[model samples]
Target: MQLTAIGINHDTAPVALRERVAFQFEQIKPALALFKEAWSGKRSLSAPEAAILSTCNRTELYCATEAQSSREQAVSWLSQYHGIRTEELAPHVYALPQSEAVRHAFRVASGLDSMVLGETQIVGQMKDAVRTASEAGALGTYLNQLFQRTFAVAKEVRSTTEIGAQSVSMAAAAVRLAQRIFDKIANQRVLFIGAGEMIELCATHFAAQHPRELVVANRTAERGMRLAERFNGRAIPLSELPSRMHEFDIIVSCTASTLPIIGLGAVERAVKARRHRPIFMVDLAVPRDIEPEAGQLEDVFLYTVDDLGAIVREGNASRQAAVAQAEAIIETRVQNFMQWLDARSIVPVIRHMHTQADMLRRAEVERAQKMLARGDDPAAVLEALSQSLTNKLIHPPTYALTSAPANERYLLKEIVGRWYSPR
Candidate 1:
């Protein structure tokens, strides 16, 4: 079977497009099942293995199949699911086959390919995707081994290098940007627009400043309340955002909503209510929780995930040495993984050889049993069994040698000579 990965990410596509294709955690299991069914049915393939990794920055499909046609089928399925034209999505999609696919998976799981280098969250996200696929019965031996090694490489990367040290996280960068707008973070009120992990992290960083007030707004009141309680803040339903948005000076939002949660009109109303006070906003969502027009407003300072890329580049000099060391470790591991894959590719041939040998041995044992049961002398039966076994072992080689063409015989001699030569 061949391994393949096809998808788009932050580098290849805009947040708008990425969000359109993003698969929520709840949707993953069903999506994987559908993908497997589609590919299997279209290509006459059965039990094709597949896993999907969807995050704010990327959506990817990793699959193992016997034919290239399966890859094309998977691409069409992804385009159809997202309701986008195949050609439109094709440009942004990357297809890696065999060893390249294996390398890509390892790099991604190791955080070498993350939006924020060395970010640890992608590792967990990858594992969750694998678990979902396995439970759905879409994972097979090849994929299982591939993912297991990917996780192992990630762990080794984390333990052997300081790649994560001195790294500026999106949450920390959001706080830093807010401080630039407001003289004292402790004096400002902070509002988090979602209860997801990104929002929780942003809240943690901003809460360290002991902000005057902290509030969490979420579609689910229970989830909002849970996150709010952690920061000694209050929870508000998302419906109340428009009316109560002006109360906070800082807004950090990262939601899975398809549309912009905070539009230009909402921000305009909020700015007017705040008496034109500057509102610091960071949108970590792919589709963008805040509208682009909101950034054009006079008193609103808006920053998207792309905007924070520059800020997160700080203090990287100190980690350069660590990155080099980590890369070396990855390179060695990648080579070993390739060797394992090579061995896996020949497993069917190995199984066939063992089966053939078992058949020959069974046939010889049956003949020896019949001779002993016929009342022949035990010594004669043993001699006959030994002769039969020897003939069975040498017959094929002897026939091949005697019937071979001149060139074939020469090639056979060369092969046997090399086999018997000293290492």
Candidate 2:
């Protein structure tokens, strides 16, 4: 089976479409179970081994299968699962087969493919996806090894290069975007929806400005409270979003909810209450917590994850040296991984050759032992054993060279000659 990576990302699709196929971190395992059931018995794909890497920027399925059409099948499955039309999704999806898949995996893990070049967050996200895949029993030898080497390459890239150090993270970009509108963050009230890692990071960055107020609203009240406490802020229930959203000047939201949490009406009302005051908003979630239409409102300066890409890429030119070094490391690792895969593909033939050779050696040894027991000369018996072993080992190739078809004889002879040639 070949390795294949199939999916759409920020580069290929809009946030509206990417979100349609995006899976929440917690939703992966169960989704994999559904995947297994869907592909349980098939002609092109059987017992499909796949690991999904779903993040704010991308949703890719890394699969081990011989199916030449696995990419199309994956697209079909994604559309069906998400209730999206195939024609709409087909154009944006990219399929990387074999070496390309390996290269893509390595690049993604190393953060070379991220909007924020060389950011470290993708490493953790990939590890989590891999762990979840393993837990879901979606992993097999091929995928397991692919990710192992992928992680090793990622580590090498991060350790050997300064790309990661130079990255302006999403949280940092969000802060910078907010600063574009608000002259002083310290005077603005900030509202953060969702207490996930992204939210925590954004809150921390904004807190440094000593914002007048920092509030966290999450599905779980306690979780929100805990995250809020870390920044000396307060927590509110998700239900309070509509009523209290107008109170804050800057709102950053990222949640796992499948639907929009902050709708157009909510933002419209919040804008009305603020009396035409500008409100900076950032939606980091893949599916997004805030509605896209909400961004059209008069007082709302809303940005989605994609909208922050330009800000995060501010100093990429300065990090070109690190980027080049990281790319070199990734290229070497990709070649090594492909070589491992090539070696892996012939493992069954190697196993059979060893098994057959062992059986022949054991049989010859048994015959020689019987001769020795019959009071034969020890020197003669030893000579016979060595001779028998050599002959038996050479027999298969000798027979093949002689018995090969007329057109194939020359090639077979070359193979046999190479096999028996001097070192």
Q: Pick the candidate with the highest lDDT.
A: 2
lDDT at 58 for candidate 1?
88
lDDT, candidate 1, 1-423, per-residue tens:
888989999789887788888887788889988887777777677858899999887899999887763446666788899898988787888888887888888889877777678899999989999998988888998899999999999899999888897678889998889889999999999999989989998999999999999999999999999999999999999999999999999999999887898889999999999999999999999778899889999989999887886787674667778878877887888789889878987999889978877788888789888888888898988887788777887676678777999989988778767755899
User: Which stretches in model 1 have alpha-carbon errors above 4 Å?
Assistant: 69-71, 395-423
Total clashes in model 1, counting residue pairs 3 or more apart in sequence or in different chains: 0
How well is each residue in 1-423 modelled by candidate 2, as lDDT tens digits? 778899989899999998989997778998888876676555635777888899989999988875664677778889898899999999999999999999999999888899989878888999899999999999999999999999999988888889788578889898898889999999999999999889989998999999999999999999999999999999999998899988999999998888898889989988999998999999999888888998887778999989899888776888888989888888888888888989987999999999999999899889988998999998999998999899889888888888889999999888878887999
Please list the residue runs of candidate 2 whose C-alpha ends up more than 4 Å from where it truly belongs after superposition: 44-46, 66-69, 358-392, 403-415, 418-423
Worst 10 residues of 1 by lDDT: 66-75
lDDT of each: 0.87, 0.89
Q: What is the lDDT of candidate 2?
A: 0.89
Per-candidate TM-scores read 0.91, 0.90
